[model samples]
Target: MLRQGVSTRPARAGQACRGRPVPFSGSRLRSSTACGAAEVAEAPAAAPAAPQGLGDLPNVVSVLRARGLVQEITAAEELEAAAGAGRLSVYCGFDPTADSLHLGNLLGIVVLAWFQRCGHEPVALLGGATGRVGDPSGRSTERPVLSEEQIEGNVSAIGALLRSVLLRNSPPGAPPVRVLNNLDWFGPMSFLAFLREVGKFARVGTMMAKDSVRTRMESEQGISFTEFTYQLLQGYDFVHLCREHGVRVQIGGSDQWGNITAGTDLIRRLLGGEGKEPPACYGLTFPLLVDSEGRKFGKSVGGAIWLSAERLSPYKFYQYLFQVTDADVIKLLKMLTFLPLSEVDALQAAMGQPGYVPNTAQRRLAEEVTRFVHGEEGLAQAIKATEALKPGAATQLDAATLETVAGDAPSAALPRAAVEGALLADVMATVKLQPSKSAARKLIKGGGVYLNNAKVGEELYKLAPADLIDGRMLLLAAGKKNKMLIRIQD
Candidate 1:
């Protein structure tokens, strides 16, 4: 998620306060120790601002501060009230459209973890039925409807990943999180019963008023009835959570404001019965993360960077974070990391300075995040693969590490008959490289083509079976960066 806003510098450190303590709070405490007869004031106390309740939350505090939603009562008041109420239930729905959750959904996952930290029970809502319908939060077009088996498979896969990630970060002695499939409830629900019970509280007028719906209204490709009913399903999710699980707050990206508020409204109507506090439900939405270029995160020239190792390798995941621009690193560190503000400020300051490089910061962010989502082993493998990117570097990587780096690269074998007298272009093209003979010729001419780890100088360079590094594999490189492996067989 890309957060908005960036001011170059906001005055120098110690410019205002020389003797006075700087107001820094949260995880920014300075520790001191008294050694026998020698007392030391470890580090100067950066007089922390008043400790906010949610500020104690690991990453949610960062999200709230970064999104500027900390001041919103509907957001904070609800969080505070939930904690105060002692195990007030809260939830954020997860639609299992894919095998694994991606970096795009990290914020929501972080929110669930934060909710749990604040001493509230978090219900992980796996959208078994709704995944079939698709939530139109950021989608430009309607997602393809999945078959029951496919949805179920995705739901199971995603549920396992979610449980693994959330459980790893579960605060010590915090409320144990619960994972619930909405399909469990919605599966047996009949259309008539749904309309009478859940659908009755949701109004068409309110649904149409949603920004997601409104955006599609003026377009030639209008919103579908299936998508429009998304709000109703989401609202019903909250209602079910409240009725069944005692969930009262719905947190999501700002785009979910409509659906979240709709759920709150439904809870008020159905459960409140004439507006007597209405279970004190609340809706909190974080700003959708976007970069300075205005492009969304977790997407690139490569496809969506997913969290699942099967869908996206931890190496690739680390690479994705490693590629964060200096412009986005500070914002990313603040949003994605549990690092202290002083440490974050130091990183930001390092990035802003002339000689200080951002690569170290990038690596730190990547390692911390990869370790958080994946295990230490995943981080280690990614580190090895990262080291492998260097010239003349070869590391013994595990199968997962190799697969992560080789992502979609094709593994093809050219027989002896095919390898003899083959044009480098033709050989490379067989593996879907260059796309066309003309493109291949252009790359060869521009010195962007290489074979057997060496540049292809001649246009008609022969790709003989002898060029194979192993019994069949030949290392190919296009330019100094792109690499591919080709094989020859009997």
Candidate 2:
């Protein structure tokens, strides 16, 4: 027989609502609230009543499925009915395996936002404890364990990022998002206590049957006992959240299906007694972000597309989305952004029309996603850098703009004498933009060399003091794609 928590049907049906859904016009949810320690307090003692215009908001499950966000949900009918009935506390856990979250981690946060928009509560859980054990859901080899100190640092950084992003995206008067660390509970409990309380309920046969566990055991680098016990740790997280904070739904990527079911099953075994009713906890998942070739998305030749501006600049993030293929843009627009379905459909339709400009949809996707992740100021910075760096574009290449684009391009320092009154070909050869002066002359003659975004047509063109932007730096482009920055040094 199927497990208590496993569902045979997909949650793709768009359940009807009383009225039209709320379109997430960015202005409605943009707030300047400070996300600090004070806001991370326990969820309010009583669940807040659904906002006054509840009828006007569509069921959150329907909204998610419409946007291609739902993969599989346990007890789909019951979960949908519960969502339509009243406010639900939905959560998604993020393990602090890295210092910053990347594009692959964005869907969970976006799902949380949708729940919040529909007037439900959203909880962001940081897996401070689980990071030490490591999840083996999608891996063939065991993960290298991190030290407690490293885990703690990662937890704090990821917690702050979640708080800021969630708070900024919350609608006005929305309940504040609760940022939690599982270590808070796991730290105090002794291993013996854990074995008695949690381990007793999990059957070895059942655990072995899990896809995550089965696949690893059959591989050459077999799973470790530490990794094998990860599901139990994650399961207990759901139980604690449900009992303490009234959280009822757990959301994650599709790879988490085994772990998520473990939570639901654990809840049923531990909390559902013969004389009592079944616990209302459930699990949901979204498809992993990947490209047409089945390789993971959110990665570039450089590295992961990070959500933190410190790790990857907003300009680079925006550029990555702006370069997405037409085949993927429409799906991403629906899944990633809060743009209305009708609007997304219009963009898709425009792509087939004769007057449609290429990359128009991509630009919109880039702008909306950048605004969500980095906010208005960051979006502006990205757009400015994009404009300033375009070869032969009219936007002035000033020092500030070049500084912003410098993070994504190769750069070097040149002596003032090397640039001032020097032949352009010689400078290009010096910077390795061309293999030799002869090659540089050939490229310049082909009108493929640009100095400060202006095309340099003459093979013998010489650099002037005026050629340097603000007499400090100059942007050099070998073509539309390859660019470098040269800073003048005395």
Candidate 3:
């Protein structure tokens, strides 16, 4: 029940789009895109369609359940009816708590894509307003309020990410995903107006009963009135989207049940009670994606696996997915990828067969997800990176690819003069590769030191100009898996 956001140093400005290159004279390595305002890769011309296996199925719930996407539903029959009813307008909201949406938000956006393929309309809501107060649903402590400018910046970057991932590969005439910011509506209303209109309909007793509030109230840090009233804001968002955009359904992660149900209840009380014919508002939630130990599975040992290649490089992103345990690959494939069920079953079957490789399943999951988020070009770049770091790739690697690899790996800087004609032992000592010159000498003599993926057997060898990839940096390794980038400062 930790709060969703973490403060990270802003990725420096030298990293810009691959198409629009930014000249770098900085210490940290950078990708082709600007880290702060990362660009989305353009999608291919074609789009994937609904499976032929789903022909005339009554609803997509069966699909979701088989895929492990559905955790809770407010109205099972009504949800089925909406899916079967043709061209439903539905949405899932994402708060701009971070500059980019992380792995946790993957299920929500993928659900939206599934609806679009089913020929329904999907809307993506950026919480320009709700993000300000912060979501308390999954937290044990109070969320620190964010500034207007900070939230707004997060809103724009996340909007671009959703659009790139969701709007690609439409079947013949599918509607493009409609993106909205909650602040567009919430910004205009005064505090007194919100209290008189939205807040007036809420019940203090029911609000107090919500698990998020109940848990927080009993904690050392009691709930704030601002957070307690957050339900009203979310409910109003549903009402506004429904009334203004013709959106009829809301979907989200399971932690959102209280807030989601609050919206449906508001719709029923405010709209259906007024003699509205259909009473069409609905809410559905999927279980939060978790691992075998039941911990949420998106954050890596490093941090949240961000969708942006600029934030989390495609190579690291692919490696993260490629490393999922055999126990979790099937469930993750069902949740994160759009592979047909038949293909998923084959991969699952392979996991149980004799001499079958788990890497096959892990590799498939990595390829599908990498292509989806980073595009085919990004996937190719990731594959090239995977090759560059392999056992025998040293001599064949090019400068730009080496730069991309350095951009993804841990890196440090040194004056060029320090590296020129410097002994391997001193270089290792300077980069913290070893505790001291003695330790560096011992490691080099013991066959533990590798320069640019090639083992170094010499303790007193001087680095030649050719040892620097692109004549700019030295790739250092203390062992098979321990590596670092040394960027030579001009």
Candidate 4:
């Protein structure tokens, strides 16, 4: 996920507060313990950031623990014991806030995937029922409720996107991920019946103590009864999964700790009674994925960096991963990829040392993650699209790939004659890359305007018949990142 307004000097990746450079001798990132890095001080006091040099580990929990993925876990010993016993069914729920999951949900997905790789059953629960009544854990205000038709549509689309990525990462013969819509169970029950059976176990005192509830309660926009009962609904979902499918563990983001615990508690109360004991159940959460500035990653001006290629093109998705800050790249690798931690440590070392090639690890992070989510073919498309925009790509890029990569910037359609005989400035203005012809000429003289991926060297440079790339198209770029595809009609 791309943080919208972060500025980090890559040259200072390994600098102490005193500005002295530290040699990467295969150890901690900082040389002097005296200067606690901004990364250390900036992280939340409750959840400490993962330490450097996180090599591969013995078990899933240990790997997550080393990678700093585990922020809060209920009954650590029992969770480990259950997982070690073999074939633990672990799940994480994704509420279809939109038709696609974003970088915000990547941590939970990756955690479930790691368990699946180690032979545990992964149950990806899509919240078809809960989406209609939004979860308020991270929101400052109440969410806009959608129609059942809209939520149901989002559920199926999100389910397909989720399954594509999770199953691609699964071993050939491994148990295919068990996907369930929460509405399957909740749909059949009456409101009164639900209250009598499931809602009865939820105590008011325990509910109010939840930070999400307490904060919303004290706010000017008091939470609605529908939203207040959300946790109860979620709690029963856990109990339902546990009883039917033998799924005893639930994992989610740190903000979901309250709801996750609610589920765990419900599991015990419903099953355990006089002369009977409850089964072992647990909840685990991953820390917030934040940059050094403490702003959540995966958000740009346009919105979230989405998991679905249709929502956010794979080319743009790869670029987002490619732009991750040097400071966060290694940690992101551990969080997002199943790459051996030793390789990540080496990449971490290289990132700290002198003469490190810019974007080497960032590219690897993009490739690994892109391949995992979008598959080999999608990754290839991303790479092809990336290269088609580079310098001297006028005749090199075919028209089809050019159109695909143009998803990055605005595009316009014009007649072939509009580009062939007009001055470069006029064409740039025509495409709205510049406000006026004069402004376009100014940009051209300053060597900021590009036609067909080639920089225009002169203010008066006129577009010629030859400028139509591959005899029929033109790609205009204002700078390195902003590209506009000029579709030329015959």
User: How high is each candidate's TM-score?
Assistant: 0.72, 0.84, 0.80, 0.80
Residue pairs clashing in model 4 are 1-298
lDDT, candidates in the order shown: 0.68, 0.83, 0.77, 0.77
Least accurate 10 contiguous residues by lDDT in model 1: 1-10
TM-score-better candidate, 1 vs 3? 3
Kindly list the per-residue Cα lDDT of model 4 for residues 1-490, writing each as its tens digit. Answer: 0011011222232232332233324422111113322111011234322222112214678778888899988988777755655556688998877889998788888999887666566788888777767898977799997876677778888888877888777765454576777765565455676777888888999999999999999999989898898999899888877765567789999999999999999988997888787767889999988887888988988889998988888888899999998888888998889898999999988987999999999999999999988999889888888887765554466676776676665778888778777888898887788899999888888988877677789889977878776776788878766778887888
Global Cα lDDT for candidate 3: 0.77
Residue range with the least summed lDDT across 10 consecutive positions in model 3: 1-10
How many residue-pair clashes does candidate 1 contain?
4
Q: Is candidate 2 or candidate 3 better by TM-score?
A: 2
| Predicted structure 4, TM vs. truth | 0.80
For every candidate, C-alpha RMSD to the true structure in Å: 15.7, 10.1, 11.1, 17.0
Where model 1 places Cα greater than 4 Å from the true spot, the runs are 1-63, 66-75, 274-277, 394-401, 407-490
On the 0 to 100 scale, the lDDT of residue 289 in model 3 is: 85
TM-score, cand. 2 vs. native: 0.84
Query: Any residue pairs clashing in model 2, and if so which?
Result: none
Better by lDDT, candidate 3 or 2: 2
lDDT of 1 by residue, 217-261 (tens): 767888898898998889888876665445667888777888888
lDDT of 1: 0.68
